[model samples]
Target: MAEDMNVSKGKLQRDLGLLDAVGIGVGAVIGAGIFVVTGVAAGVAGPAFLIGLLIAGFAATCNGLSLPN
Candidate 1:
């Protein structure tokens, strides 16, 4: 058991750099904002919120496709 634990610990590495950490933080904030906005939109729009969500998703898809490589 002790040898197995030592091997597991040695195999793990702290590999995240500054940019990776920043990207993760930004992604988390944006994800939280999306959840809050969805809740508020649902309360205000009721059943219509689903329709708006579909439209938003379609728009996002289009926007993503239009981005230059």
Candidate 2:
């Protein structure tokens, strides 16, 4: 694989380690969910709003994990 590359091109470097990568991905998902769903969930469910988010996340995750590869 190394031999297939053009040696004249600059090498690419990884700036994020595994922890940073996972944190970034999780942060984006949580941030988007908070922005998109927080107000509506609050108005609808009041103090128990988080249960809806948790249930939806659980269902989505289960569905995702059960899909055929």
Candidate 3:
């Protein structure tokens, strides 16, 4: 799946230390969003795809490390 990405997949699963269960969650997330959302964003937003990815990635980064209550 990650291999199919046009960009390099930098061992995010390994770094995340998620066992099979949560890894599946992450894959499901990326797969769903990357599949459905990317085309829409690219079409409507066009040249902002890269910039949008940067912003979305930053948001995702913050979300990832956030502590649970």
Q: Which of the numbered candidates is closest to the native, going by highest lDDT? A: 1
Q: Write the per-residue lDDT of candidate 1 for residues 20-68, one digit (tens) a residue.
A: 9999999999999999998998999999999988998999999988968
Q: Return the lDDT, model 2, position 28.
A: 100
Q: What is the C-alpha lDDT of each candidate?
A: 0.88, 0.82, 0.81
Better of 2 and 3 by lDDT: 2
Q: Candidate 2 has which clashing residue pairs, if any?
A: none
The residue ranges of model 3 lying beyond 4 angstroms of the native Cα positions read 1-34
lDDT of 2 by residue, 1-69 (tens): 645754435676447899999999999999999887878868888878888778989999999889686
Model 1 lDDT on a 0 to 1 scale: 0.88
Which candidate, 1 or 2, has the higher lDDT?
A: 1
In model 1, the worst 10-residue window by lDDT is 5-14
lDDT of 3 by residue, 40-68 (tens): 87889888888979988999999999999
TM-score of 1: 0.62
User: In model 2, what lDDT does residue 50 have?
Assistant: 83
Off by over 4 Å in 2: 1-37
Query: What is the Cα-based lDDT of residue 59 in candidate 1?
Result: 97
Pull out the clashing pairs in model 3.
none
Residue 53 local lDDT, model 2: 76
| Candidate 1: residue pairs that collide | none
